[model samples]
Target: MFGAHTWRCGQRYDETMTLTLAPDVQHHAANAAGRDFVIGDLHGCVDALRYLLHKVGFDAAHDRLFSVGDLVDRGDQCEEALALLDKPWFYAVLGNHEDSLCAVAEGRLARHRWYAIGGGWAQGLSDHALATYAKRLRELPLVRVVGEGETRFNVLHAEFFGDDADLDAGRFDAEVRERMMWGRELAFNAARLPHYALSPTYCGHTPVRELRQIGSQTFIDTGAFIPEGRLTMVEALTSRQWSISVQAARAMGAAEMTLP
Candidate 1:
């Protein structure tokens, strides 16, 4: 782990330099019988997600949903969002928020720090509950390669500082892993050189006003927790996209829908 330093966005956090149990990378075979969808940071908006899934006619029997992570935090449906992990059709990578939660669960990060950064929903939870959530989140890979050949793409929470070879081999050191979950260079500076991931990499830690792509990297976090923000979903193979504002999703009776 990198030296304990102030995190991005000028937020000061006390991060313990400890190794994580999660695998750095994981691979999934292409969906032969159904379509694959990649969604932006959930931020605990499970109802909104359900609404979008219903709007898209998602078939749980055949289709799969991949998340860029931050599945919990800043919204009222955190438990519901985390519950998605139990569904076989849902997959996700680890985001920085999850990382902090893990640290807190392990007593490496202070609880107040986590609360200050949108994890307030966890304030009253029992220690066992927090540990359980952390354990589940720790099982998530930092990066996921989905599909194969020309249709293949990568899903991660944030920037990858290394080249395609490093990513392919999962040769990430602590610094690389930290950058993968928290880096924002690519999101803020589109023209920066060395955008060299071989596969189309989809990331979501840094929310953009709209879907933005630089080289092979796509930023899909549209700030669903913000008043004017919306949740974005993209089909991994076809690059087709759909989005709905939080208000709009709620107005559509999202709360009444169940995950399919």
Candidate 2:
């Protein structure tokens, strides 16, 4: 991929700002000499988030957590979702929902999708706290990099290829939009990873039927929002990646919560 884009605050953040990768942000996946951890979309599934992190034996006090975006939407745990910062974490760029959320907080937009994403749960909170949280969500990072090895791993909400697949990061694929909003097709498609970008991408925009690998790319979005209540995770130790469900890994987590 060419590189990330720069996004100026669109009445989303309370503080005037621009959302872009740090100028120095570049291929780090190739740099991760050893193991690292990455996660898929959250979609307001806070319990799944906590369980997945816990099952992976994530050491927030030390290691890192990278995420594909859309952390808030179509789920019941909005408040707890943003609590990701409670540990070491990175947010790959997501879709317009996040940008829209920021806009609403800046008072530049309305909370139309908020209800769609369970923002109504906060209707009982004081108006000031609601606004405060909105501002916090506005400040989340769009992407992250870890380690420093030959297989630079890039984390993002969705794939970076364009319709032509020849386009750079500034350009995008048509499926990217479909993947961002409705990701049911993410499963069978996991095998086609590196074919999409220069770096091995970890994504969550599309919820796949299973945790499958294609080339070096691995998909982690397990549709925690669904009644099945399963979430996918990637374990990066010594540069090698592994995936396991909380129910499968935690003995008593969510047995029926198997990956599809």
Candidate 3:
């Protein structure tokens, strides 16, 4: 973690211009002293998520869990993945996979396009479940800002575009919105990084062989969608980490079916 405290927009500014925090955003730490964990892209691996939580001794009634999103699609447990939205302690940012699912619901994208990109399991969802998941995804914010001062953590699905004004105002044009789901330049280009620096922002989109940390930005997507990959969960404040590989997940009988 960086020592210098990054400056963020004050809360007193005009309400209309500032993007409001996620509905679940903890204005004040829920436990103040309790643990909070952030998981990388899930991609419908509910069994792996469950095993990780069990391994961590997570207390759903107390501890909080934040996800980098892509909670659905690509895996066998898509239905169970959608159910996480109902968990009181769970919070998530919108990932590109969720973005595409939303687009499918709104008729902006063809169903086949979603399937081609590992969304075929959605076809198995009952109409009610599909609608319910869509509604839940609609409620998710593009960003989740947690803590304040040096402890401040920005949770987003992908890279943050350098737009303090638009973000502070809670307004994002099509480009900014698109970038949130698909941008990689910020992570791939070291020189383009400082321009967008802020409180440590945890994001997942570009899958890495392992966790990658550059300054305050941490990318934790370990390609859980691939059979050889693993699910990763990191305690936000403590930085305590836990992982469950695909083989381990299977050995634990985390899921009945294997990923494609």
Stretches > 4 Å off in candidate 1 = 1-20
Worst 10 residues of 3 by lDDT: 1-10
Sort by lDDT, best first: 1, 3, 2
TM-scores, in order shown?
Answer: 0.91, 0.64, 0.82
Per-residue lDDT of model 3, residues 111-217, tens digit only? 88779888898886665665556666767877787776766677787777663333445566556666677777777896755755566778898888888886657
Deviation from native of the Cα of residue 48 in model 1, angstroms: 0.9
Task: Write model 1 residue lDDT over 62-166, tens digit each, in one string.
Answer: 999999988988987788888888999999998888778777887877889889888999999999999778767767888898877786889999888665668
Give candidate 3's error at residue 86 in angstroms: 0.2
Error of 2 at 172 (Å): 9.1
lDDT of 2 by residue, 44-137 (tens): 6665656555556655445566676767666766666666644444444544456545545556554554555545555566657766765555
- TM-score: which is higher, 2 or 3? 3
* Candidate 2 whole-model C-alpha lDDT, 0 to 1: 0.51
Best by TM-score: 1
The 10 consecutive residues of candidate 1 with the worst lDDT sum are 5-14
